[model samples]
Target: MPGRSPRRSTPQPATCRTCWGGSDSGPAFDAYATAWEADAKTLTDALHELADKIRASKGAYGGSDGLVSTQAARVRVGDGTVSTMPAYAERPSALASY
Candidate 1:
């Protein structure tokens, strides 16, 4: 990315009165500008979709439910059994259903 212009630069034809103004590579400039616009739009849309998926997946595992699931699993190593434990106990919540 060294020496590359940032994509946020205005997307205009080579002769549009900016750094590219008076340059003879007008067609090449137009091609780059058009590609940048398309790529920027695609990146924006993909980011929005990723954010929505993250928001939807929240809270599926946490608190007491998560702790119970972990404690039930056993791992064997060198003829020894080890069980997973939560780092901290789940806090009591008045709103929590028993």
Candidate 2:
């Protein structure tokens, strides 16, 4: 529909009714794994890169975050159902530790 809005993404798992167990936010997430000590920086950098990719792909899938969101509207009218638009991603209320 012409007035339909796009879906948004939530950064934290809390909105999904769950909690994230890992710390891949930046370089420190991988640092927790001792075995990856040597490649800690590399691993976190890759993680950051992966996060970027996730955001990039979303814009094409009806998402507004410019990442994991879809690039276009995924809902079709006259399907007898309404799309549950995703909420926009917002920064955490407080800084969290891993």
Candidate 3:
């Protein structure tokens, strides 16, 4: 995200003209830099939006997990014990084929 931040010192048309001795390519370089800066800003904005969505989703998932755990704890098996699922790592035999 930092790398995609808009450059503060983007080459101005005047600066490009000076660098190129007022050559015809100066305008072209200026146009290219302007377009690139605009694209970078767009990308930065999109990334920020994506980060916000991810944070919101994370909070939602945490709340859902807690609710599910509470519900699971309330259910009892035939032995009157709380039933729980095993983690994938605890079931290596189930992944033997993979």
lDDT by residue for model 2 over 4-68, one digit each (tens)? 88877766554333335444433345455655675787889999999999877765554445443
Candidate number achieving the greatest lDDT relative to the actual structure: 3
Candidate 1's TM-score? 0.39
Model 3: per-residue Cα lDDT over 1-98, one tens digit each = 67696758878877777777667677777799999999999999999999999999999999999999999999866766555776347545776988
1-98 per-residue lDDT for model 1 (tens digits): 99997887656653374455556467677799999999999999999999988766755444556777787665436447555865577899988886
Computed on alpha carbons, the lDDT of every model, listed in order, comes to: 0.73, 0.61, 0.85
User: Which should have the higher lDDT, number 1 or number 3?
Assistant: 3
From the highest TM-score down, the ranking of the candidates is 3, 1, 2
Using TM-score as the yardstick, the better of models 1 and 3 is 3
Ranking by lDDT: 3, 1, 2
lDDT measured at residue 73 in model 2 versus the true structure, 0 to 100: 55
- Where does candidate 1 have its weakest 10-residue lDDT segment? 13-22
TM-score of each: 0.39, 0.27, 0.57
Number of clashes recorded per candidate: 0, 17, 0
After TM-score superposition, the amount by which residue 91's alpha carbon in candidate 3 deviates from its true location, in angstroms, is 33
